[model samples]
Target: MQTVIFDLDGTLADTSGDLIAAANACFQALGHGEVLDPLADALTAFHGGRAMLTLGFERLGVDTSDVVDREFPNLLVHYEQGIDRHTVLYPGAIDAVERLRANGYAVGICTNKPEGLAELLLMRLGIRDLFGSLIGADTLPTRKPDVAPYAASVERAGGVVGKSLIIGDTVTDLNTARAAGVPCILVGFGPEGSGVARLNPDALLDHYDGLDQIVARLIGHPVLV
Candidate 1:
């Protein structure tokens, strides 16, 4: 089966708002009081909890991974409490996935987000059942930019590794596809906008509306089982 694996954060959904809020919770608790601006720092938010915390610490001139590590759990806790408060699926995302599935493409998710939180967010958004697999940061010993999780996601979704392509909005996603020797489709509608084009992925997605065509063009259409 052909597989279409998606990145969770800025690809399928705009999770930056809630992600920024979670990181701000950690900084607020430490008396810093909302160090990250949800709109401006959305790209950083997609980078993950640690990145947000690291940026906050950097802003305060507290340079140490140790502090970010300690506050990570706190960020996760706050995130869990309000995961979907401001998150929303990208326009046509759900429809595009459904179209892919209907056209015989196996669909799955590969996220740097922890498994539990990814699961929670998907469920909260009422889109959990859409994917055949959910491989998160902790799903394997290592995550994307390493081919392991990507392969795992394709295999778990009952698709061939040779017939897979990744749809994401970050360099991590680009690197993952490169490692797997597969096509990388980067989203151009996210915070980085046209900036992602500099990475020169296999394709740049302006919107989810015509994603299936991009997928077919890059990797060939599914066999239509």
Candidate 2:
């Protein structure tokens, strides 16, 4: 079976809303005025929590260490509280996963996000069972753009490097695939820390619907219906 490994955030789901709200909650706890809209904040920090916190503190002229100490925990707490409240599966993502599974493709997730939180988000999205394996940041001592995580995900999914595909939204994702020597597909709607176009992945997908064709082209097999 063709194995498709996915990145959790930005690729399969839009988690910016929840993340933004969590950051705002942290700011509120710190007694700092709200600096940005929750959704906008999440989008801006699509990279991760540290990136968001750094941006927030930089905007407020606060020390990074201070912000990390006082606000980071609050942010995590808020996120844990409503982790799934506004998070959403990207359009056509569920359909694509289901189609891939139905076509006998083994699906797995390899993400830098914490394992516990990633699992929670997937379960909340009602797509947890769709994946055969999930390798999160905490799953190993290191994460992407390290190749070990991808290699581990493939191993867990019962796939080989030549038979697996990595799908993500950032250059980091493509770099991870390169390090793993595996094929990769890029999502146009995801983070794109620099620019999605600059990454030059194996394929560019405008929507999750485009994933099916991209997979067909890469694996030379009908992995999507």
Candidate 3:
């Protein structure tokens, strides 16, 4: 079976706002008062909590990473409380997934987010049951860009690595597909806008309405319509 693996943040959904808010909460605890703007720093937020902490710390002229480690857990705590506060699935994301599943494509998520957080966010978004499988950052010994998690996600979703591809919004996702020797379809509608094309993915999806045809074209499935 053919499989379509998705990256959670900035791919199927815009999770940056809540992510940045969590990091800002950590900064606020230290009297920094929301050092990370949910709007301006959205791209950085998708890089993960550590990146946000490092960016905020740099703003405070603090060169040490010890504090970043210290505040990491706190950031997670804050994030869990409001995971879906400002998060929303991209337009046509669910519709695309449904159409693909209806057409016999295996669909799953391989996110760099922790397993628990990914599950929680999906459930909060009321889309958990839609995915056939989920491979998170800690699902295996290693994560994305490492082929292991990607392959695992495909297999668990009842597909083979040879007939799989990834839809994502980051370099990490591109690297993951490259390592897996699969085509990468990046979302041009993500936080980086059309700038993601610089990575030169196999295809750039500007909207989900055309995804059925794009996936079929790239993965060798018969065009759905």
Candidate 4:
């Protein structure tokens, strides 16, 4: 079967708010007081905890590497505790995934997030059972932009790599799909907005409502309107 692999953060959901909150928590612990802004630093949040910490340290005129390494664990702890507080699935995301499944496509997640954290977030959102497989940063020896994890995610979801496609929000996901020799569909609603088109994916998804058609077209599957 064909697969539609999704990148968790910034793709299926807007996780930047909670991510920034977690990073800010670390700064607060050190008397820095919320160095990261939820609105201004959203893109950095999607880049991951380390990136957020580094940005915070830079803004505070401190050594970023040492602080990032030292407080990374604390950031994760705070993140896991309130992962879904401000996180929410993009509009029509769940419905689109369900439609894809009903149309005979295997849907799964291949994220750079830690496996346990991804599972926890999905479970909290009440959508863990929706995916056939979920491959996280540590699930395999390597992560995205490396074809290994991407292929693993597809196979684990009972899909053929040749017929699979990836739907994501960043260049990382685009590169991963390219490395795996599969089509990629980048979400236009992400932090980068329609500017993601510059990356030249197989397609740009403007909204989840059009995902089924986009997936079918890219993967060579037919869907009856």
| TM of each candidate vs. truth | 0.97, 0.92, 0.97, 0.97
Q: TM-score for candidate 1, please give it.
A: 0.97
lDDT of 2 by residue, 1-225 (tens): 678999998889888888877887777777887766765565575788878888888898887976576666677778889999988888899899998888778889999888989998888888899898999988999899998889888778877767889999887889998998878888887654436878688888888877877897788674444
Against the unseen true structure, what C-alpha lDDT does each candidate score? 0.93, 0.83, 0.93, 0.94
- The segments of candidate 2 whose C-alpha lies over 4 angstroms from its true place after superposition are 191-194, 222-225
Candidates 1 and 2 compared: the better one by TM-score is 1
Top candidate when judged by lDDT against the true structure: 4
Q: Write the per-residue lDDT of candidate 4 for residues 64-175, one digit (tens) a residue.
A: 7577899999999999988999998999999999999888889999999999999999999999999999999999899999999999999999998999999999999999
Show the colliding residue pairs in model 1.
Answer: none
Tens digit of lDDT per residue, candidate 1, span 40-85? 9998998888989999999999976599899999999999999999
Worst 10 contiguous positions by lDDT, candidate 4? 216-225
- Candidate 2 — worst ten consecutive residues by lDDT sum? 36-45
Sort the candidates on lDDT, descending order: 4, 1, 3, 2
Task: Record all residue pairs in model 3 with backbone atoms less than 3 Å apart, i.e. clashing.
Answer: none
**Deviation from native of the Cα of residue 92 in model 4, angstroms:** 0.4
